[model samples]
Target: MARRPLVVIGSGLAGLTCAWASDPQGCILLTAGVLTDGAASMWAQGGIAAALSPDDSTALHAEDTWRAGAFAGDRAVIDRITGVAPEVVRLLVELEVPFDRAPDGSIDLALEGGHSRSRVAHAGDHSGAAVTTAMARAVRAAPHVEVREHHTVTRLLADASGAVCGVEVRRRDGSLEVIETDRVVLATGGMGGLWAHTTNPTTALGQGVALAARVGARTDDLHLVQFHPTALDVAADPMPLLTEALRGAGAKLVSDGARFVDELQPRDVVAAAVWEQLTEGRTVRLDARGINRVATRFPAVAELTAASGLDLTRDLLPVRPALHYSMGGVTVDDTGRSSVPGLWAVGEVSRTGLHGANRLASNSLLEAVVTGRAAAADAITWTGVWRGSVRPADPATVRTRTCTAAPAASRPLPLAQVRETLDSACGVLRDGPTLQAAVDCLEPHVGDDAAYVAWLIARSALAHPLSVGAHRRTDNVLPEGVSA
Candidate 1:
């Protein structure tokens, strides 16, 4: 029997978890950039959501997740993920992940927005970093996994019968290669980089969603983009995130010399409040003085503030709302299976309805672990019954086309124009006229870089007339009927 190959795309928690669970003897892992580059998994400061506390049950965690998702979440998926979270955390611990522990040697937990209890297991303020680094180390040591850096997947290849077979990749050197495989898993991160101001790496340009869409996969809830309420507004272009855990630790948000607002509000509400402050010509600041004594509790936050030339003890760190996560992407089933046969998606790349209209704090990473592992198990079962060899196609013979590709002589729209248009029309506040204008402006450059991203965001935003979660439309005020 010929050896079957499993191809996993992206190097974040979801991709890494799938690779680890698949246990494929000789698997090929494709990443668009370096392991640490452009991955939202590394930028995450909040801890993972799990039922680690004796007071916290999986039912409570699931309920919280469902509530935070605006009741649009799939209940079965929520239950499945929350149920496995504790075990997933334990597995990470056994892998040598140094999660912060209590004095009694139990896992330390913290609270964040939308949660009823302190059920977040963290590693200081760098939980995502700690888990990502640890997982990457394990992946590197695994003899069966082959990590391919700087390989961009341009398209997913499906057979004439509409079954996924492999992918066409554009290498770092601008050369193309086709890798044949029996199964493919997309773990690519979110579409935050498409926005002007975001905490995600610039490389997260909705490539995964676009690629999946190109292959005729069903996508869902594309308008739901989460905005972090407190990204440090400094010289940083993409912006630096100040974790919500700071609020959990008692930090407050206030305008210049004014009273502070409640710090425990939902991210969408808090982000909108911060945006309103900015629109009113008032700079927002995160007051850390009250929580300065516990600054040692969050070493990463303290170190980042100090590195940015601000002393938590004396100076207030400037903050603003920035695009953070996407609650939509290629649609997947309960087991992370996409509509396309032989293909699965996990993590931020797949819109499994687990997040619905809004994502709960820290649940993004939890979904990645749970769905990645489930996808791997499902893929193994799928490949067992489906036996077919995929032959590589000649690079020159296969069409080298792009959704944005135009005639060689035609001048393409500039990226700067697209960015400015999105910033002005499709940003924090939206009206029907402005959104329509945005669609009109983006229609001309449909296949262009900025236009493609703007198209997805604008179209999706337009589809959901009611305001929900991070997406807000001034013209279409959400009806009272739509309750959270």
Candidate 2:
């Protein structure tokens, strides 16, 4: 019998990198939407982080990463990921992804919050879209790689011994089918979409978390979700993000038209500071008046602001803390292997211990490519023996659900009730009682992917007693009632 193809579940940079690195002839790429549009990667505004400047080094980058994650991340993993960051940038350049360049032809780096050096390489403000478009072009030309769009993987398939075999997919026509495969790489995006106010696509409901957990894969740090402090406070669902690059360009955060928190502090600190102001009913906004050629430097942001009846050059854009990134996920090793056998995770889906609590501004894109390559290299050679279990499960799938299905809704749970529950219980400030209450309220809806992930996040928050990084708890007060 012929060997089954390696299945990759996502279209983000991580998934694309895995497909390009793997044996293309045996690689199958699946996307819940169009190849380039669905991923949160394309929504990324700040660029990839790298220590490529003359005055910088990997050690400094690693130091910044460890500090931003609140010292809880694995130091070794930070060193490994930061060490390879420069090379990742070079690879992207070679692939014709145009990074912004200085006058002397050096990679122009932007200094975002929590970084000691200007090491983020970007192409304008649409860094994610530009990079993803270039990678998608390359993948489209690769004849051996099969790209399937609009096919949502509802569940992961595993044998009785806990070795993964395939996935249950929801097709475009509203029918479900199963694809049999031995290797599965989940590059699914973060759980930001579960929150009422987030920057991620609505479909990014942590399907990867639910799918993996149902099969007994271990997850961690689900509570360590980073809330970006400057999402444009409009009436839109999934609020538009104000790029950290603005702060790097000298924008300031102001309340009552007066500056308050330092705009370039670590994300958790800045977010909490902003949340304090918001709770006090003060208006927080990103003041971008000082940036020269603001529209030219950040055209995408200019467009977004223009649509909202404002100008990045002249307006004090109202802002608030909103769910931006998840720092914890299905726990994985250096090679993106989850505890479960024959299954791997990369990108935001896998907790590689690189981002222990709060992620540095641009480290996510770097980790995506680095870990994606690792999982692909390992998956290419694995012989389907997971953790010493030699059970030879056939690559045949069995469908367990009825063919009919309801059209997927944008919000997973009761939109109004769950939003209030998550924002109040798992928002910037959290406590034991509220976390437990949020879990209890959402427990009945755990069958829904969004609600299940929200429940997982709340449960994780309740389990960790101390206020560390993004997982802040009001009740876990220290000597000064602040983090050390």
Candidate 3:
């Protein structure tokens, strides 16, 4: 009998990197949509963070990341991830990622909020798109890897011993198929779609967290989600993001035609300021007119703003905080292995403690590549062990219900209601009563994956009474307008 392939779920940067890295030891890559079509990686504009400049060091990068996350991250994990960042960039370069170059022919790095130095290597403004596209191209050409597009992994199939042995995927035709695999990597991205306002694709409803939690995997910091301060405030579902790199390049966050806060602060602080301004009925806009070559350097952002009738060099782009990245996820180690045997998670889906309470700007892409590569390496070793001794277990029972199927209840709340509940209770700031209310509202729909994830976030927010990083509780004493 032929051995089963390693099954990797998700087609974002981490998933693509994992599939691409698992070279001779091939794997099956699964995605709900076409590769890179709806993944958040394709929309990322800030670029990858790595300490490649002369004055910058990996130690400084680690320190900056730790400080940005409010010193709540694991120092060891921070060091480990940052230490490999430059090498990861080099690997991307080898994969033919077209990083923007300086006049000297070296990779040009840009500075972003929460970083102490110019360390972000981008390809124009669509850094994530460029990098993920390159990896996707490589994965397509890889003879060993099998790309299964439009196949959504609804549930991870675990044997009697609680080891993942296969996956139940829903094909585009609404039919289900079971693929046997000893190793499974969930790179299903973040839960940003749980919010009514988000920069993530509507499909990113935290399915990975829900799937992992159901399988007894430990999830950490579920409430510590980071909100971007400058999601373009146009009438667009799933708001367009105005990249932070604009601020790094000398844009200003202005409200009432005046700069209210430093633009280069950690995301939480800036977002809080922006939120405060919005709450006070004051307009907040990102003024990028001063940034030279704004159109040429940030073509993606320029196009996004143009579509909204806003110009980078001519208009004060209206901005507001929107659900961006999640700092919390299924708990995993350095190699991205979860508590359950044969299960691993990468990218925003797995919390490696690299971004404790908050994520440093541009660090997400770095973490994605590092953790994805690490998981791929470890999965290869584990796959060898499984093939050597492990026998195929009985065909596992697969759940027939859609992953988002709500529990049998009279008038279970719809997803729109759930999103509203979460958005109201969990924004740039939170309080006990509001969160408790949100949790109570979502409790009845636990059967639905989106509601379940929303419940987790609300419950976690309510449990942590103190303000820390992005999980800010307004009840906690905070600076004047920020807590307001």
Candidate 4:
């Protein structure tokens, strides 16, 4: 019998956690970049959502999650996740993650937008980075896990029976290799990087979504994309995120010294308010000056602001909405089983109905941990039944076809064009005319990597006629029949 490999793709929290939980004696973890380099998890500052507060209950957390999801969430999935959240937090603590603590030695919690209680566990403002680094360290020390860098998965290969058998990946040197495996897991993050202005890393190009869609996976809710309201509008092109924890700590969203909107509103409300202000010729700013005394409470935000040449005592940071999270992807069950056999998805890449139309504050990290572990357990059970019959596919030898002449290198899309089109047509406002115009303007570059992402975004945006959660349309208002 041949040795079977369990291949896990993407190196973010979801992928790493799955690898750790699978405990596959010799599983291989493949990633396109540094484990922490391109993941949105490292950029998360608000912390993980869990019912760790004595005053809070899982029912309350579930209620808030369902509300933020615009009532489209699956109650069963929500209950399961909320019920298991405390254990997930415990697992992170056991992994040696340095969570912030109170003077009395209790775990400190913070509040963020769309939450009724202070139940978020954080490490100041660097919660995601701390958790990711801790997990990466543990994975590295584990003798059974193998981490492969600079490998990008191009396509998922299926056997004659239409089950996923392995993956075809492009190496750093542009060579392709097929890794035959009995099980494959996709932990690729969201599609925020597809937009011109996003807080996500450049590597988040919807490769996983595209690959799964191409392979006939049932994807849902692709129209819903969450926009974070406070991406610092500085010299940075993609913009840096100012965590929602600042608002939860009493920072105000003001324009010209007047409070323009409720600071504690859900992300979509805040983002739309800012967009309205921008359209009205008023510059939107997040007022953190009043919270300067509490600056020591959030070391990460304070340090980052200082490094960016802004003084919390005097400066009102300019901000704008940027692509933050995706509430859509390949559909999956509570156990992370995809529509296809021998394949699973977890984290941001999988639409497990936990987030519904929009994700609640700080819930992404929790979802990743819970579903990641479940996927691994499912894989273990699956291997028990299928391992005996699985065989590695033989490498096919074929001659490479060479072109007679070299074609000219195509010029990259102009930055100005990319930004203008998205801002005008696909920003906070949308209509039949604008979406059609956007599709026309971006159609020529559809085959381009960035253009494909833009295309998928627009298509998804156009598919749904009603505006829900993070998605808003000037022509369409919230439906009266739908209950929140």
Q: List residue ranges in candidate 2 displaced over 4 A.
A: 387-412, 477-484
Which segments of model 4 are wrong by more than 4 Å?
A: 24-26, 383-423, 440-449, 477-484
Across residues 207-316, which tens digit of lDDT does each residue of candidate 4 receive? Answer: 77766654445567776778899988877756788899999988988887788899888788888899899889999898887885757776777776777898766789
lDDT of each: 0.79, 0.85, 0.87, 0.78
Backbone clash count, each prediction separately: 1, 0, 0, 0
lDDT score for residue 353 of model 1: 78
TM-score of structure candidate 2:
0.93
Clash list (residue pairs), candidate 3: none
Estimate candidate 3's alpha-carbon lDDT, on a 0 to 1 scale.
0.87
lDDT of 1 by residue, 340-366 (tens): 677788999998877866788999988
**Which stretches in model 1 have alpha-carbon errors above 4 Å?**
1-4, 24-26, 292-294, 384-412, 477-484
- What RMSD does model 4 have? 5.7
Model 2: per-residue lDDT, tens digit, 1-484? 8888899999999998888788645588998988966798898889999999999999999999999999999999999999999999999998899999999999999999999999999999999988888888888888768999998899998888778988999989999999998899999988777788887876677878878876777788888999999999998877889999999999999898888878899999999999999899998989888999989999998898888999898889999999999888888888888877988999988888998789999999999999989999889988766652222211111112232123232235675676677888999989989999997777666656667677777888888878999988889845445676
Worst 10 residues of 4 by lDDT: 397-406
Q: Score candidate 1 by TM-score against the native.
A: 0.91
Candidate 2 global Cα RMSD: 4.9
Which residue segments of model 3 deviate by more than 4 Å? 383-412, 477-484
lDDT of 1: 0.79
TM of each candidate vs. truth: 0.91, 0.93, 0.93, 0.89
